[model samples]
Target: MGVVPTDNELTGTVRSLRTSNSGLGIPKLLATLLSSQPEWSVSEKRLRKVIQRLKSEEETNFHPTSSLNSALDVSKYSNKLKPILFGPEKGKGLVATQDIDAGEVLWREDPFVYAPPWEIYEAQMAGTASWQDETRSNLTKGKGTSNKLGDESPLSKDAIWDTYRSFATLRNDQRWSHTSENDLARSQLENTFRRLHTVLINALYLQHSESQEDVTFDSTNTGSIPAPSRSAAHTKQLKRLLRVPIPEATLNSLFSWDGLMEGLGKMSLNLEAHGGLFPLHSHLNHACRPNVSIRHISPDGSTNSILHSPNPSRITVIAASLIPAGVELVVSYVDPSLDLRSRRRELRAWDFGICQCGRCLEEENSNSNTEHPEISGNRTKIEGGDERDVGQLEDELRGFLSV
Candidate 1:
């Protein structure tokens, strides 16, 4: 007779049954077991059906398509590339579905949100309640914020307290809420009133926009998110659009003393300060040898302008080399022209990962071989015995520092 099952073995079998059945109602479980496990012979199709049923339930109740996933939906972007869970270790990367030629425009993206230096400066100026012309006019009186508050830059704690006081004062004024001028001033002057502070506000606002259906912030009154304006009139209107309300919880989580420090960390890791936050662009992993090069293309038809502008500009990723279908696309995050040591160090420090690309690996091996010539010679000989092999080794040795 087959070994008699112990109580523990029976318990384990029942547990597996319960799991596979997904805690179905007693009546359903009895019927399913009777039909699927007749004579204890469950088929693969029945087990698969159980898994599909469980997954369908999970999808219906527990998991909704997330904002990031929604943003990355391939149909919304190009047909040339697709994002996927690249490999076991690398989380996400873009792969080519079709063979791409050199210099082809693989993708173009506009920043979801960005903060240029000017907006931050304007916010700082308004938060201080010091119109430069007014302050300059009062300079002769020696009683203006330019003199008494000259030491208080927006980054200082004193300036932050001043901003809070100023906001409170403005709120009390009858014109502050409805009057466009006062609304504009208060809009720019709220929060920490620093450039970085304003940028974080924008970043949070975009996140809020993305996840609004799933979660609600305390206040949705954060006025119209700031955008680049070309005229004084446009700037005035942009500043007065609307005020987004900051929930006390959100303030604590993102802008309190510790939260302020954390915002900087987010900026470093998640933001492209000069470039703006391009969710799709940030997904591309780094490599020592890159297949693509990014260029800031003109918002117009031509691709000339490469400098940061007041507004978000279109950025294009061009193929630098012919890439085959299904190949993982990579671009260098750090300057590839730097010496191997410097490039590796920069990648490790800023990117937080050592590149394992072919060039980086070769550099590492060459460095090791140089420190031990005998080992290098033995390996070179082991690789081949003919003159062609010797010539190849010499060429590799000569080109060791080329990258």
Candidate 2:
């Protein structure tokens, strides 16, 4: 023998042999594709097929196994606020298991589940026929997606869409891309991260829509999702319309709870805001003279989470306002001093039937009759001649409050 091989050496030889030779013959460039990954070293089984192909000499019934089982994740920290609902249960509603106090920070949560923008586009293209038709009819066609962020010459659309976010793909997608020049091992090993602040911000906005009209795009115009226009400029404009923001601002301007007002009328749940959101706070029933109020803390310059931990990735919920025994713990979602009618309207939009709480009933009884001066219309008389214009009054109220 050239050299007497030990058991370990013999095993190693057999492995190399198994990798390089298949039943018919050895493999070709497969070895180069897998073994020379610039990122990290390949495992035995990982290189087997490539080696076999390079050798062009196959073995009988060869199978190479590797230690590439998927990693297991068993963390129990899920967003516990599963069923955020608005309802009028003759039942006690979402009552506080413990007492809450004023200036207390309630819990917060990542409200909206975010998906990659590319994935969003893909899903929309697949189901929404309007978007697909519009895209295909364009001179650019599929090129609408992968353009660079800025194309100075474009009359139509700019190119940012086609740019693949490698980090997002790695974290969520495992369909291993064959197009990239980077080695598979290197790509897999990369720990790059990109912040998705926009999704969080949109979630905040969705929680409270300051511009009521933004709630729904009055789809009276059936020509939704834009018709294909010949001009690249118009196509670009349509593209812009289709895009949602990618990053959300750290500071989100607060909205007085128009929705909360309606909830008060329905006596559904009382919710108070101490700044951050909470697990079950939204589910609290409403009482006119609620026990809780939302008090916003000052915003910091950089992005911040409501949670007070050293690493504020997760949000925390604490009591902002106090709750009382047998008080049905209500908190104001919007400004507290709203008159009964406006309050009822707001609650109605929030899906509450009516405000039957003590305060609301009192106001309604008073507005209906002049005899009870005690409840005399709670609304101040408009001293000017514009008293009859309830519509104007509504507009003024909405404008002043920024709801």
Candidate 3:
């Protein structure tokens, strides 16, 4: 019987609370949200649930390892790897709980979702146009088209395609504002955004299959559109971002683009370029000389005898070296054989930071020094020799260094 907060209002309230310097508790956060929307008859209990959900969502993005580890535990499959908080600067990372020898399996997980290349989506779009034209013609002629595959399920192809249309229509709100200098950049981003949108839609549909709750919508809550699941929150956020109306439930639910962008960014930085979204494997940080190596084995269970069982396809993380108990587990983000400059440049450009591993430190120092330990003995011998020998040695040193 009262006005409920709009999706925009709810999103704004959560953002405000998160950005505030003061650590406001549940009581204060609820009070702040209520105060911001006094016209709404939001009960304390209902508001608390909303606040908690948003906070938890924020925490999952900021500290990804917690959620990843929790998923691992819930699976009930014995995993040797554990997630560890490496402080605010480093974020969350993985560590070994026991000593692991080379070639021993540490952890194996199926990707939460995998996104195919953009070309597939482009082809699908071209195909859909012809179908739409036929549908329009049938409607104009007062004819109803029959759905021969009449399953009418929530995850039906028709429902998924409808959701995909809504998702794809939304613009890339993250793109730069219109300007002369940004014209070309914006043009390029259109294709990039479309590619991302396609992948996000597919991933969201896959994630929805894992949701346990039923979808419920409020009919008379004035100005309010509720999105029940975290997955729904994701789609609702994207709808809000593009100033689109809140999505209505189709086949009992709607897909979200909310965490898709953030998840993609994390995947880019943490996962191997060859890999897609392996949630558990992505948590392991980078090291110049990593103790772990990932092996991509076929689902048919070929090559490795350990993977002879009928498990789903997975990228197995095996110990590359003997890792001691409580040691941090890491893998190289880039080829370690590259020079110090190349390694750091690759990390800075793509991975967002340079490696602080021991191998990196040793290489950096050795590369910076003018004299090498191998050539130090040569210098000492020349100093003790006659002037003629010393001159010849100096010339020879210059030639050797140049080569």
Candidate 4:
């Protein structure tokens, strides 16, 4: 008589089989188990019971509605700063809840989704000989590569689900919406998605390649390895896993060409230098003279001390100057030292139009006065006239201008 399999052993086998073939029915699953483990005696009725219990447990644990609630929650950071609508034109902005002293920390937040540099992503997609050589050289030197999280890492189903959820949340969030219908905005949206698509394609390729390599390595080391070549069927399974099943409507809304472009535009506006999008930090509007300073710091607040410390994922918002309660917190999106015209030009290119900040207004007014026709005419007369006349005219103009 063959040895009868215990309930625990049957449950474990069923789980492994289901993980590999999610669509396998109870009858087929039992047949596969029996064929593989011919020495073990198991009844089809007992196997069916185990599968049903597992399905019930999965249904109870996984709630689709709450999958993203934790990722989108900003309650922890709400005590110091809050989002307030600044009218239709300006939309929403962050405001200080109470008087904040200079150098005080307002909040620290992690990026919703962080990506590697555009150049790196492009290189990976192209798979150029130079890039391959560089990667090999770095490996030889014991140097770390650009995509530490992605390179040679086993793809986790949970990580893929989390990434998809975060992206979906970003796409649906109305706070990041831009109501502009200008050609410049449209151009920017297209460009943003062009780059995003490249990155996504390259990421998928990398994961698939890494998974294949893992399979190859395991087969070489162990005599008993399943799916030696990681066949097309297995590849299909991996692609399905990476895709993360979502409703047709939700998928269309998140990934349709127009939807993708719009989503990328929102990300482009708020993405940090290293391609990170912070939730609360995105609410701070631009200012010529910003009251808040943004800093990337390690958990202990010292980045330089740790060699190759992972990209300082957490950003600290410090009060650059004393900020009064209920005041809108702002940060400089461009260099503050830039002159008025140069600053305005840069801002315009970014679709921000002219800045109306106090410093910019004062500078613009001063420039306007200096260029006034009367002032120019008086200056010209003074330059061409005799020294005595020039002095008299200067005195007259100064008095007229109340200088």
lDDT of 1: 0.54
RMSD of 1: 18.8
lDDT tens string, model 3, 348-385? 55535556678877765665431432221222343456
Worst 10 residues of 2 by lDDT: 72-81
Which scores higher on lDDT, 1 or 3? 3
Ranking by lDDT: 4, 3, 1, 2
lDDT of candidate 4 at residue 80, scale 0 to 100:
67
230-331 per-residue lDDT for model 2 (tens digits): 346656887998795643332221222433343343332223222223323334456666654433222462332222223232333445457543335455
Residue pairs in steric clash, candidate 3? 234-258, 235-256
lDDT of 1 by residue, 31-92 (tens): 66546445454434554555456557555542112213454666566788887774434556
**Candidate 4 C-alpha lDDT tens digits along 1-403:** 8789888888888888889888878788878888888898888888888988998977664221111123545568757666766654465677878788999887777777655434554433333211222244244324354444454334332233234434434433445445565556655644543444333333344433344233222212222223224557778998999889788888876876545533543453422355666777767778889998877676577744221235445677888999999898988877888776556655665546567788887776776433421222222333556433333465467558866
TM-score of candidate 4 to 2 decimals: 0.42
| Highest-lDDT candidate | 4
Per-prediction TM-score, please? 0.41, 0.30, 0.41, 0.42
For residue 125, give model 1's deviation from the true position in Å: 11
Candidate 1, residue 117: the lDDT equals: 28
Local lDDT at 360 for model 4: 80
